[model samples]
Structure formats: structure tokens, C-alpha cells
Target chain A: MMSELHINLSESLKSKPASDALGFGKYFSDHMFIMDYSSEDGWHDARIIPYGPISLDPSAMVLHYGQEVFEGMKAYRTPLGEIAMFRPDMNLKRLNNSCERISIPQVDTEFVLEAIAQLVRIDQEWIPDGEENALYIRPFIIATEAALGVRASKQYMLMVILSPVGAYYPEGIHPVSIYVEEQYVRAVRGGTGEAKTSGNYASGIKAQEIAKTKGFSQVLWLDGKQHKYIEEVGSMNVFFKVNGEILTPALTGSILQGVTRDSVITLLREWGYTVVERVISIEELFEASRQGLLEEAFGTGTAAVISPIGSLSWGDKNTEISGGVTGELSQRLYDSITGIQRGKLADPFNWVYTVK
Target chain B: MMSELHINLSESLKSKPASDALGFGKYFSDHMFIMDYSSEDGWHDARIIPYGPISLDPSAMVLHYGQEVFEGMKAYRTPLGEIAMFRPDMNLKRLNNSCERISIPQVDTEFVLEAIAQLVRIDQEWIPDGEENALYIRPFIIATEAALGVRASKQYMLMVILSPVGAYYPEGIHPVSIYVEEQYVRAVRGGTGEAKTSGNYASGIKAQEIAKTKGFSQVLWLDGKQHKYIEEVGSMNVFFKVNGEILTPALTGSILQGVTRDSVITLLREWGYTVVERVISIEELFEASRQGLLEEAFGTGTAAVISPIGSLSWGDKNTEISGGVTGELSQRLYDSITGIQRGKLADPFNWVYTVK
Candidate 1:
């Protein structure tokens, strides 16, 4: 699949950042992957070019119409000193789903996977080995047409850039406070909510900023239709443990299906825990807290495998969850998932794709 | 305000497109206006440089998260061989409102108006002098910070580009067929519908494409919450005349407050017509058609001024509006607005801003 891939290495590679100082998405690797799509050529001229600025026409449709989709994955340095990816196939599938929803052309998944592997191999030395540190992989496509119509662009550019990072949260694995937002809506059914598109993220900044100003680390979004049902926490899929049962919002065409979320659910189910995927309202969760039945809560995504919720608040109601600390189950799930990703634990689910 | 403005003229200008051949947003003028924004320096270093491609880092936030807002207005060559703008202050004011909604920094509207006047003065020849011809001005701001974090950017670039446009619709002045979209939602009450941001436009592409497949010119979006009430017709604000009353959707948070829509309402009210701004449902519209009370229907925006709707369809119901032709009121409104815009009609409302 990479037979036609062209390589253009950087003339002077960037100095690697200290592992301890590597904040999320700050520094880029020396080389990045790029592919172009046109109506005539159909995704031709795949190449690895020097990581640098991309020149775009001022009227490029992506800048004006938000015609873009992105995927976030990571490459980890294993215990044995080999690089591996955690469920990259899932990311590729989700990327295609996003493309279908945004009316952009989908890439061949297998071919794209091979491209990722080749790029990672060339920049393998750039991957950091600090605790919870990995090479953050960002694969995004933008409409590159120089025209200004409302329709989909006939030209597009898909690029994959690698960024070395420490942790998604500034506090690392500590539990964080979340505010339940009722004012601004993120995604609604029949909208671009389920897709991993830029518009969904753009619509979320105001709510997140409000939560931030209120001293919350993230905003727990309610459904757009009624603003009652819990949809997602920040950019991740959320879950709650009440008594002995696990609850997660169903993929009801508005919530993004996170890869780590699926892994968490599967792991819990395999361990004989009952995980329910249904519409969970904020009122029900508040009532559960009032009854002293809400045990643990967390958000799951690629950036943070498991972000435990220490405190939750909405309107005038606020409560500390799990005594404002990471719960036992949250720690265990994080260890198990990260362990599998780092090749330190047994791969019972065949989740890790080792790059040769 | 213009003291700090710097001008860098292009060495060579491209041949202007033939007035008849000018399509929407196809040809760019020789020069464009640009301004950079940083948290520390504020919006500074405003300049007019040769129109060309802009260089952006691969991880620019706008490319990944769609942090962008844009405005659409035109520079018209009036009958007196002078340039004029139609309510540009309104466009700039709305641009600020869009910036607030998207968490982008707001530009000084009065200062930006000077910037637009200077840019148009430099490229005044780009304004085509044909019937319904104007220099389409697109002013947009994009987040330029090159980072992968899902947050507001600290750096941004605001740009103004000019394109000689003939008409928004290829069919020109004819009534268009509209599909009442129920399966795909454009916006909900708490969404970014009222803002002139990129995400809203991106979310509408799929529905528009589907409508095109069904032989419709555009999609008439229903409310996201119920998918019952009419929100917008294509990208424009919609209006209907039923039983001698002019009706348009109210300025709900989810509907764009178009400058042209406001103008039409004012003109109708001045003509002693009772114009009602309230919620109008698709069921009510169909019932009006059934009872022979449905009259003229059209969409209003900066692009088309007034686009007459000939036929509308939803589910199994299809009806011809105004006997499948342009309504008398629609034509009269279009003529009155365009005449005022072209300096043929008396400026009773002081809507035209003459550019020196």
C-alpha cells in the first residue's frame, strides 16, 4: 500500500523536548504524512514531508465552511522498547464514519493504517518514554479548494502529524471537577454530533469556557433537545457507577463513540460487571447521589484513558464523588488499559497493534 | 484608525474576469486586507498585501477545531459610477456577535469599517459594473494557534478577500424549489445557529446534498428540537404571505438575524403591510396551501437579496407557491431593494454607505 509513498525528510530535525517538559501537543516530529484528494485524481500523491507550515488559499473552504474531520490516537513505547498503537483500526473506522457524515471522501482504512505505521517508524525516536507519555497522533483532513461555494470541496488534503506529550490533564491522573452545563448545547440528533468533525468541537468552546471560568475543569453537556439527559463530558464519553451497576450513555446518534469507552465497557463486562447503555438524565444522577448510591464516575478518551470525576455540580447542587478522590475501579481500568497499550500486561483482547 | 494601516501593493495584477463570466467567489482581487491578533499585542499590524495563499501550521486550531467566524457583504458600483456598501456596519456588528458566540476575540467594528473602506478603495476596479454585479467581500477570522488542545486559541488572523460575483444562483432571479428537511437538523435553540460561524454551514452540507439529489435547489431547515416548525430556507431567512399577512420567523436564538431580512420587514411595514414575526410551522403552511391561502414565499440574505420560492416539498406533501412563479410582492421587494442598492431608488432609509 505504501509503494507509491514519497519521502521528504527534514533538513534539520528539531531538538527533542525533555520528557518531563512535554506538554500535550506542543512539539511536533520531524516528518509528517500528507495525501491529496481531487475529483480527477482521487487521493493520489501520498507522501511524508517535512513537518512545517501548510500554505492554503485564503478562500479555502475549510477556513470558511468548517469542512474538516480529525482523529486522535497515540503510539506508545512498550516495555520491550518497541512502538505499538492501541486500537488504531477503531480510529480509522471512526474517521471514515466522520467523513461519511461530513460529506467528505473516506480514505481506505487499511491503506491509511499502513501510512501511519510507516510514518511512526520514520519518527520512532521522537516518541517519549516517560510515565503516561506517548506520541500523540493527529490525523486530520481539510477542504483545500480555493472556491467559495456552500457545497463540499472537490479538493482536500489529509495530513497526519505526531506530537510528543506528557498528560492531557495538567494534574495528571488526579480527579477533576466537572460542571454540568445547561445553557449551550454541543450536539443534537440529526446534527454533526456523532461525527468527529471540527464543527462539533467548535460549538463546544463557549460551554467549556463558561465551565472553566466557574472553576470547573470541564463541562458535562446535556442533550440539546431538552437539556436534561446526560450526553458527554467535555470531549470524552462518560460513565457512572451506581451501587454495583455501570451506566453509560447510549450511542444515540449524538454522542461520540470513544475507543477507550468501548474498551472500558468491554473490560467491565468481561469482569462480570453489568454495564447499562441507556439515556441517563442529570436528575437521575443527582437523585442517585442524594440516595448515596453513586459510587464512581469518569470520562474515557484517547487523550486521557480515564479521567475520574472528583466533584460534579449543576445549578445550585454540588456533590463530592468517591470522597473527592480517584476510585479503585477507575485506577484499575486505567492501569489495565494503559498496561495493555504499553505491552506490560497480557493482551487478552488483542487490542495492541505492534509496529514492526 | 487608519494611521496604523500599512499598504503593500501587488507587483502585477491578474486580468479581471469578464463581467458576464464572473461567477460567485471565483476570482479574487489583487490585494487583500489582513490583521493579526495575539493576547499580549491585541489586534495589530493591519496591512493590505497582495492576495495569495496563507501559510498555517499543520496543527492550527482552526483546521482541527473550526474556531472561525465570517461575514458576507458586497461593494456595489452605483449608477453614479461610485462605490457603495449596503449596511456594512450591520455586518460588522453581526461579526462581533459571531465572535462572542465562538469565543473568538471581537474586532473593533468602527476601526474595521475603516479597514474595509481602505481595502475597497485600493481595489475599487474589482467591482464589476453589470446588472446585479458587485465585488463580493468576505471578511473572516480564523484561529491560527498551532496546537492540538481543545481550547480557545491565543493567536488569530482576520482577513478580507474580494471576489467579482455575478449572481448567487446560477438560474438567476427565478423561483427555486425547496425541500423541507426533517431528517437532518441545521440548528437547535442553544446551538450556534444565529452566529455567522463556519460550523453551522458545515453541518448543513449533507442535507443540502441530499436535497440536491432529490432535485431540490436547497433545503428548508426545520427546528432541530421538533423538526416541525420552519427555521430557515436554505441559508437564508424565509418569509411567507398568507391571507394578506406577511409572516417570517421570529428572531429566536436559533435563527440568523439577516440584514436583508430586517430590511424586507422594514420595507413591508413602511408599505402599510402587516408583517408578523412569529413561529410558523410546516403544518400551518401546508394547511394554508390546502385552503388556498398560501401566497408568496421567499428567502432573504446578502447573497441573493431575495430568492423567491416556487415550490416546496416535505414527506408526501408538495405544493406550488404563488402558482410556481415569482410573486408580485417578491418581485417588487427585490426590485426595491436592488434599486436602493444600485442608487437608482431614493435612499429614504439611509441604508447605503458610500465608500470614498
Candidate 2:
């Protein structure tokens, strides 16, 4: 896959911010990766250039029709002074599925990995060197065709950008309040819910904002049809431990198959926990909470490996979980995932792909 | 509304192709309308700039969260050689509603129209003269804030680009084959379905492409829940003539309320026809077709004023309507709408908002 990635260094570089002060996606690296796609050439001309503004036609399909897909991962400066990525294969694999749903051409996984590894190695200085900090990697593809009609674009741009960031929780892994949203559904079966696309994020924003005004950090979405089943929490896949059995929504064509969700499930099963992937309706969850059997609840995503749920408000009722503190299971999962990511713990699953 | 607009003419104007060769949104006019918005200042800095590429940071919210909204309309060359816009206020009003749904800042309707008028006037030569050829107006607002968090953007850019488009159907208005889709859903209740945003269109492309491959010109979308009732056809509001009364899908919070759909309803009622807006299920439509009572079917949209549906394919069953030709009512509706648009007919309804 050595297609000779042309490198163009920036003549003037912006000063890198302190890793502790860096928020998510606030500061970018000096260099980034780009690959172009067209009907004739397909994906070609892979290059690494200075991070700057990307010029697009005003009528680009991505802006008008939203034919875009993205994935989120992280690059960490391991304890051994090596920069490594955590399960980038999972993110890229899911990205292909998202692209397929939108008719975007499938990317060469090996080629993309090669490009990402090279880019991360070149911008190794951006990777934060702390237990709570890492450089976030955002790989995205957008329809670049400047057309107005409702059709698939003949052109696309696959780009990879790196951002230095601190921990997702500024005050460490604390439980955040969640609003149980019944008015809006995140993604329904037979929709783009399982895919990592921009449209899904766009549609869920108003609900998220409303939840914020209600003193919640995120919104817990229900099923689109019945609005009875628990779908996901904010942008992460949710898990609930009721009566010592961990339960998460099954992949019913609508819930995103988060990498962190998959990792947590594997780790829980390995640790002799009964993890079940099935539909847990809202009524069942509320009943469990009422009976004081809801032992633990958390969300899993790339940004926040494990976000504990302290409270959940549904209409007039608000239920406090784990006594408004991080659950024991949630803390263990976050510690193990972050430890494995930073090479402080042994990678039994070989999930960490180190960059030379 | 009387704010002064700053104008920046292009140093080198790109030549436009012939009207016959001009397809939809392929080429742009010499000038375009631009505006900026922020949470602090609201929408301001209205200006007319040369049609060129727009530069956005890689972390723009529109690229990730997809907080974007747009409107589709046309600037017409009236019979008296005046450039007029048909119900543009309606389009802008709907755009505002869409922005509200997605949490984007709304632009002043009057100020936006003023900018559009000034830009269109400056690029007046780009407007086509024939009935089938007119300048397509695309007004869009995108989240320009450079951040990766899944929240509403603090900054936005509103731009209107003009494209000289030929007739929707180069030959003439004719009947199109439609595929009744049950596999994928476009929008669901309490979602972004009613909003004229990019996600709704992005989610529908795969279904649309599959329909095209199945030898159909458009895909008729059923409701997201249960996939029972008819929702829309190829991004257009659908109407069916059952027995003697006209039936269109009621606004169930999942169907886009189209401007053309409204105009058609008004014209039908004024002409003493029963236009009922109610839920039209697939079973009822098929039953009507079997009973020889399904008189006609057509889709109403801005792109194509009236597109007659000739044949409908549902699963293994196929039904031909109106003897596989354009119906009389469809032809009449098309004539009336186009006539009003071009000022060839009386403006008794005052639907067309003529630009001075």
C-alpha cells in the first residue's frame, strides 16, 4: 500500500496548546491526511498537508444533501513512549458500513490504516502524555459533488484530522444526569441509526439541547416507532445492569455498534459477568429502578469510554442511580479500557495497534 | 430590512453554458448572496459576493453534526420579461422552521430576500428566458463553527447560489414509474422529517438509488412506523385520485409540507374539486387500483411542478394508472401552476410573489 503519500509541510505552525488545557476538537495538529474520490479515479491522490481550511463549492452535496460519514478514535502516548491507537480497525470497519448505506465507495482498509499510521507517527508530538489525555482522531468522508439534485454524488473527499484533547470529563469519570427523551427518536430500524453518519447526529441535536436546559448532560432516546424501548444514550450505546445481569440494546438495524460498547461487552463476559444484548423496554427499566434492582447504568463510546449514569429524568419522575456516584462496574470498565489504551495494562485482546 | 449590502464582484467571471445544455445545479451564476450568523450577534453581514469556492475548517459542525438547512426555489423570467420569484417567502419561512428544528439560527426573511434580490439582479443575465428554463435558487445555511462536540454550532453561514437549470424533463412532462418502498423509511414521527434539512434527504438516497436500479423513476416512501401509510414520493408530496376525490397524505409530522403541494391544494379547492388530506394506506391504494377506481396519481414538488405517476410496483405486484399516461387533472394542474408562475394566467390567488 505504499502509494507514496505526498507530504507538504506547513511553513508557519501554530503553537500547540497544553495537553491539560486542550478540550475536545479545539486544537488540531500541524499536518493532516486527505484522499480524493471521483467516479473515474475512485479514491486516489493520498496526501499529508498542513492542517487548514478545506475549500468546497457552495453547492456541495454534503452541505445540501448531507451525504457524509465519520468515525472517532484516539491516539495515545503509551507508558513506553510509543504512540498507539485503540481498536482503529473497529472504527474504520464501521465507517465502511456507514459509507455503504449512503452509496459512498468502500475504502481500502489496509491503505487507510497505512495512511493513518503514517499521519499519526508524523504528528506524534500532538499525542498527550498523560493517563487522562489522548489525541482524538476523526476520519470522515463527504460528498464533494457540487450538485443540487437528490442523487448520490460522483465525487468525495476522505480526510483524517487529529485533535489534541484532555479527558472527556474535566473532573474525571463522574456520573452525569440524563434526560429520558420521549418526544424525539434517535434512529429507528430501517434507518441510519447503526451507521456513523452526520444526519443521525443532526436529527438528535434539538433533543440533546432540550435535555441540557433540563439540567441533564445528555438525552436517552427511545425507539422511533413505539418510543417505548431504550435505544441509546446521547451518542453512545447504553448499558443497564438489572439484578446482576448487564443488558444493552441489540443491533436491530438502528443502534450504533460502538467500539467501546463492544469492548465493554467483551471485558464483562471475560470477567464472568452475564452480559445480555437484547431489547430492554423503557417500562422494564423504570420498573427495575422502582424496585431498586437497577444496579448500574452507563454509556459507552469512543469519546467517553464509559460514562456512568447518576440520574435519569423521565417526565416528572427522576431516578437517582448508584447514589449519584460512579458505579463500581463503570469505574472498573473505564480504568481497564483507559489502562489498556495507554499500555499501562496488558492488551489481552491485542486491541492496541501501535504506530512506529 | 433596509440594511446596506456590501457587494464584491468577481475579477474573472466564469462563462455559463447554454440553457439547453444546463442541467440542474451543475453551473453557478457570477454572483451569490452571503450572510453570517453568530449566537452573540444573530444574523448579520449581508453581502453579495462572486460565485466561488467556500473555505471551511475541517472541524466545521456541518461536516460532523450536520446542523444544516436549505430551501429550493426559482427566479423566473415572467411573460413581461421581468424576473419574479414564486412564493419565495414560503420557502424562506419553511427554511426558518427547519432551522428551528435543527437549532440553527434563523435569518430575517426580508433581509434574506433583499440579498437574494440584489444578487439575482446583479446576475440577471444568468436567468434563462424560456418557460422550461429558469434560474434555480438555492438558499442554504450551514454550521460553520470549528468544533467536534455534538452540539449546535455557535457560528453559521447563509448563502444563496443560483444555477440556470433546464426543464426537469427535457422532452416534456410525462408519467413516471414508481417503486413502493417498504424496506427503508425516510422519516419517522417526532423526527427531522418535517424539517427541510440534509439528513432527511441523506437517509433517503439509498432507497432512491435502489428504486432507480429497479427500473423505477422514483420511490414512493411509506410511513417509517409500520410502513403502512403512504408518505411521499421521491422527495415530493404525493397525491392519489381515488374514485372521484383527491387524497394526499395528511401532515403527520413526518412528511415535508411542500409549497407546491399547498398551491395544488389551493388551486383544486378553488376549481371546485374535493381535495382531502388524509392517511392513504398502501392497501387502500392497491384496492382502489384493483377495483378500477384509482383514477390518477401524481407527485407535487418545486423541481417538477407535477409529475404524473404512471406505474407503481409494490413487491411482486405492479399497477398501471390512467392507462400508463398523464392524467387530465395532472396536466391541468401543471398548466395552472406554470401559468401562474410565468404570469400567463391571472393571479387571482396572489400565490406568486413577484419581485420588482
Q: Write the per-residue lDDT of candidate 1 for residues A178-207, one digit (tens) a residue.
A: 999998999999999999999899889998
Strongest candidate by TM-score? 1
List the candidate 2 regions with Cα displacement exceeding 4 Å: none
Candidate 2 chain A — worst ten consecutive residues by lDDT sum?
Answer: A1-10
> Where does model 1 exceed 4 Å of error?
none
Candidate 2 lDDT, A138-241, residue by residue in tens: 99999999888999999999999999888787876889999999998788887899889999999999999988897889999999999998999999999998
lDDT of 1 at A262: 96
lDDT of 1: 0.94
lDDT of 2 by residue, B1-356 (tens): 64668998989888779777877788899998888988998888888888889999999999998999999998887879888888988999999999999999777898888888888888988997666888889999999999999999999999999999987766568999999999999999988999999999999999999998878998999998899999999999999988989999999899999999999999999998899999989999999999999999999998888999999999888999999999999999999999888878888878776677
Q: Each model's TM-score?
A: 0.99, 0.99
State the lDDT of candidate 1 residue by residue for B207-267, as single tens digits: 9999999999999999989998999998899999999999999988999989999999999
Q: Can you tell me the DockQ of model 2?
A: 0.88
> Model 1 residue B153 lDDT?
96
